[model samples]
Target: MLERLLDNPLQDPSGYRQRCFEVKQDAQTDKWWLYVTYCFPAEATARSRDTVVGVDVGVSVPLYAALSHGHARLGHQHFGPLGKQIRNLQNQVVARRRSIQRAGRRGVVDKTARAGHGVKRMLGGTEKLRGRIDRAYTTLNHQLSAAVIRFARNHGAGVIQVEDLSGLQESLRGTFLGGRWRYDQLQRFIEYKATEVGIEYRKVNPAYTSRRCSECGVIHEGFTQAFRDQHGTQGRSARFECPACGYQADADYNAARNLSLVDIEERIRVQCA
Candidate 1:
């Protein structure tokens, strides 16, 4: 399978250039896998990247994107179902492992247990469990990132902006990737994919992005995730209400609109004034 994928056609007209190669060996089967990275010249667009699409990342929805200047928006319906499917897959794998561990601890698997090895090798080793989770996240990241890029391109957006990875530790406490590796992976995929089509990608400071209202620009200090918890609103349908202007919208969507602005701080100042 790897060979078939890596085999580049000899007379292919595609201008793909091989950039790098990576190889890894599976601990369970001792099988080796090869990964080849390729790059191609950027395809020019009719317009420059003057328009921007703001993307907000979160645990449930994964991504919420919108145009900087218009009413167009992309919500969970566009980029969230796959993430939930992948999360369910990871949960199933974890539940099976836990069942094995419990059985081993209760002496139910004494026949299959090896000395000093517990039941780590029963269903599959720890490595195998980790591999399944990793593969799930990798697929989720690629599909979600590709969807974001496609959304931007279809709307003629030249620039793609997302929040910088600060304070992500709090939001990702219970997540599988712990917010670091997975967040970076998704960001990098979007950036590289955007670059392939002459689109500019940027990570902007995320300060007050969630609190600031996209409708009125008022920074509601109380509009945090904790507030959502109190209101019993979560997931893709989470709501954000502005106390100042009585504006209400999906929490992630409001944040995404704020991120789409060129100068978030300046816009806040002007609106607040």
Candidate 2:
């Protein structure tokens, strides 16, 4: 379907061109919809320059991005009122489910049946809420990507270093920490936007990036309290410390530095190879 749509402009008999085309559909409410993008390239070029960006994904902010020009952009939309509403809805669903189960055990079928209906309604609402959250996240991810691209254009950067979040899933699975974080979707959006903007994006192993200090290369079990206090401690999903130097930054920044170092190493390796 996407391929057909992409080829539509070429198939036009009069040679008319379609510039902005989007595939979207109404899902539930009149205000809600789904968007499947098939953005066409305006031009083709292989000699485009690369821009380097470092991204840190978290549950609180979803994205903590640093461009190569020393400018940092934080994404806080994921932690706003919409997220709070989603949490509230989730709590209601859980309470309703529990109430239904209890009623079933007591042989009270009348209230239990109504409880089942309520659960269904809540589940339906939750699904719609999830779609809205997904849309918001998608928008935020693209904004971050565009910001990185703009920073690169302004600073003459050509390569971007992003942390590999593959293991995050395995680490969070089956825990209370699971389901709250949506790392995979955010990564996918970032990759797509990077490719669209012709930026060279690389993912490095995130192992110990948080625990290894960016300055002085000292490794610690956790970041010091002073370090946390300095960085405001709002988005420190990981921790690190450097005893040799009094360097203190968010664990995400340390990880970003690790990613940058890895990008440099890879470039050197490619040159050597």
Candidate 3:
């Protein structure tokens, strides 16, 4: 049930209507948020469009964006340091979990545990660490997403294109490569910000984005599972090679370009429309 009334209601409140609402509370802070649904025409939400930038999220680089209208750089390395913090935090959590398991096996308990005491020291530290990790994630995600959108807009891009990484999780499950491996959260942030700013957001299936050469039509030989490793630039290959046409470019940049090219027809159609 809703705890309070809405400040702005588009539909009639008294009349029965098909509507939905969601209420969520922040687990760590105990803060509440409400989300509601509203229906509106496409033109009412659509914005002016000129160019689209195709973005590639990867393990080596935090972001590799290819603009439809202009040149694009290869990497957003600012996330490297932030990712370090996140990885360290995750390591600490793993270590704590191990210690907790050991203690449980040994039947160790705090002095007040038998007195109905709450919040064990280890549990408290873990929760506090979890909170810090959450904040770091939120900060990193917001900064990365905002900067990407700003960069696109500066390059005359009004629509942002990204890979639909719905199935990429298993591939990136373990390694946190240079703090650049949070594709799902990053993409979600990008999607929401684009919508909030009245820009366009589109995602395409991310298949063969790395293997297919951006310049040539031929698919490159291939990269191996070693490419999935986090150490020493395995995933973030500095360069890619096309055997058929001898085309060479930065690996991440090549992927971004391919993503941009993938949506060329649609981008052109939308601009013309």
TM-score of each: 0.80, 0.59, 0.68
Best by TM-score: 1
The better candidate by lDDT, 1 or 2, is 1
Scored by lDDT, model 2 comes in at 0.53
Q: How accurate locally, in lDDT, is each candidate?
A: 0.75, 0.53, 0.63
Estimate, for each residue in 100-119, the C-alpha lDDT of model 1 and write its tens digit: 67756645536543633555
Higher-ranked by lDDT: 1 or 3: 1
Scored against the true structure, residue 220 in model 2 reaches a CA lDDT of: 63
Q: How many collisions per candidate? A: 0, 7, 0
**Preferred candidate (TM-score higher): 1 or 2:** 1
- Rank by lDDT, highest first: 1, 3, 2
* Runs in model 2 lying further than 4 Å from the true structure: 1-51, 58-61, 67-119, 170-179, 222-241, 263-273
Once superposed on the true structure, which residue ranges of model 1 sit more than 4 Å away at CA? 1-14, 20-24, 93-120, 173-181, 234-238, 265-273
Which candidate leads in lDDT? 1
